[model samples]
Target: MKFLFDIFPVILFFLTFKLYDIFIATAVAIVAAIAQIGWLWLRKQQIEKMMWINLAIIVVLGGATLLAQDETFIKWKPTVLYWLIASVLLVSSLVFRKNLIKLMLEKQIVLPVAVWDKLNLSWTVFFLLMGAVNLYVAFSFSVDIWVTFKLFGATGMMLVFIILQVMVLGKHLKPMPERIQTVNEQDNLIEKIDNKAGKK
Candidate 1:
């Protein structure tokens, strides 16, 4: 499934880091990311812009870490990606008058514009906070601990955030009488979330 495909790299990186060193884990992650994209391309699917950005971070930051024989660059990777996404979401919402969360979920779950704005702002704030947390853990903890934070802590928080989002959205779900949309739209939302997961 798309979810599995999206998480394959992070899982691989975690396992690789456990069995080997950070450099080895970085190499494995980069290869896994590339393979994921290639597999999607072979299916004639369009890769999300964010997936390419993730790959870039892995290769560039991971490459720097490997080249300098230092883990600092790699440690900053998640924070960099997180802040970048948060910035984009905030800018798009405020400057361009675009609510990305609503853009992604509008067809699947109808809600008032004000509610969508709140959801978008919520995600923007979440990403900003997540970025700060990544940096705090990276600098305040050991390499091993940071790796665990990257894989488990970040993922756990994300899952919790998603659950809360669902709970909030429950009250805003459109009435059943308006369920004229196809299942494909719902599936697309899943795909969107899966692609978003590529940030890790």
Candidate 2:
């Protein structure tokens, strides 16, 4: 499942850490993530830019952790990644005349550009806050606690943000254009009928 694929790396990272150590766990997680991404690509999934960015960040940070012989470098990985994505979101929302999220998402979902920009800006701030929280926990709390927070806290925050977004977008999510969902529904029905006939 899509949800499991996205989360497998995080789960593996924690498990590997418990089995090995921070540096080795990061190395193993990076390998596992690459395989996961490759599987998605082979399955013809839409590989978003954010996905690639995440992979690159992991590789770089993981490598840094190995080369430096410092777990702290790896510990800061989430903080860095969160803020970097947040910065991109903020810049796109502010300077781009068009909403970057809209450009990426419009082909899949229809909504006004203003609403798209609002969503982008909200994500930007949310990511920034997530990054700040990561930094605080990583430095202020024990490393073990920070790792637990990394595994659970970020995920919890993201899910809450998504649910909140759905509520916000509900008002703004344009009624599905007949050309989109309706047409797809018809195509699926026809395919099912053809398959049933073939089986008969």
Candidate 3:
């Protein structure tokens, strides 16, 4: 559900492009992004920083597409956004010695420090490659094909990457301390009960 929500604008853009044209699609995408932020604001939800960044990028690039009557601006939007994310991930890890991925997921899953670094670096590289791939598709193909790739190809790649990451993480995740403590408590209680029953 959250994934669908996150990609709502892209889905709308693809459908609009099929029904209309690139210009109309770009407009719809811009409106959809604004509507997302508006809806969240109305609901008093804490809009994430990424959401705001996405909204800003769409408004600027999509607006340029509309104002200048050129689809190039909109086509570049994905690459720009992807590269920005990759830069953030790389800079945070290398310069500041902070692993943003670990900061986000450490509370939920525990892993060795080396694993955290590797995970962060992996995501950074993935986003960088994805940005380059978007550029390759956007310029190498027709607008229709680019739109299709934006909706399906890009999304499919991201899903596949996440599945691969999950497979890797599965091997390294450790049992939470709380879970271990609960299991130990249960075992001790069962052992005491068994000893009392044996004496009786």
Predicted model with the maximum lDDT: 3
lDDT of 3 at 159: 97
Evaluate residue 101 in candidate 1 and report its C-alpha lDDT on the 0 to 100 scale. 85
lDDT per residue (tens digit) for residues 1-200 in model 3: 98999999999999999999999999999999999989889999889999999989999999999999999999999999999999999999989999999999988999999999999999999999999999999999999999999999999999999999999899899999998999999999999999999999
Tell me the number of clashing residue pairs for each predicted model: 0, 0, 0
Q: Distance (Å) between predicted and true CA of 191, model 2?
A: 24
Where does the lowest 10-residue lDDT sum fall in candidate 2? 92-101
Clashing pairs in 1: none
Clashing pairs in model 3? none
Two-way TM-score contest, 1 vs 2, winner: 1
Model 3: residues >4 Å from true position, as ranges?
186-200
Q: Each candidate: what lDDT?
A: 0.90, 0.82, 0.95
Off by over 4 Å in 2: 41-46, 179-200
- What TM-score fits each model? 0.87, 0.81, 0.93
Please list the residue runs of candidate 1 whose C-alpha ends up more than 4 Å from where it truly belongs after superposition.
Answer: 176-200
Deviation (Å) of 26 in candidate 2:
1.1
User: What 10-residue stretch in candidate 3 is worst by lDDT?
Assistant: 101-110
Give candidate 3's TM-score: 0.93
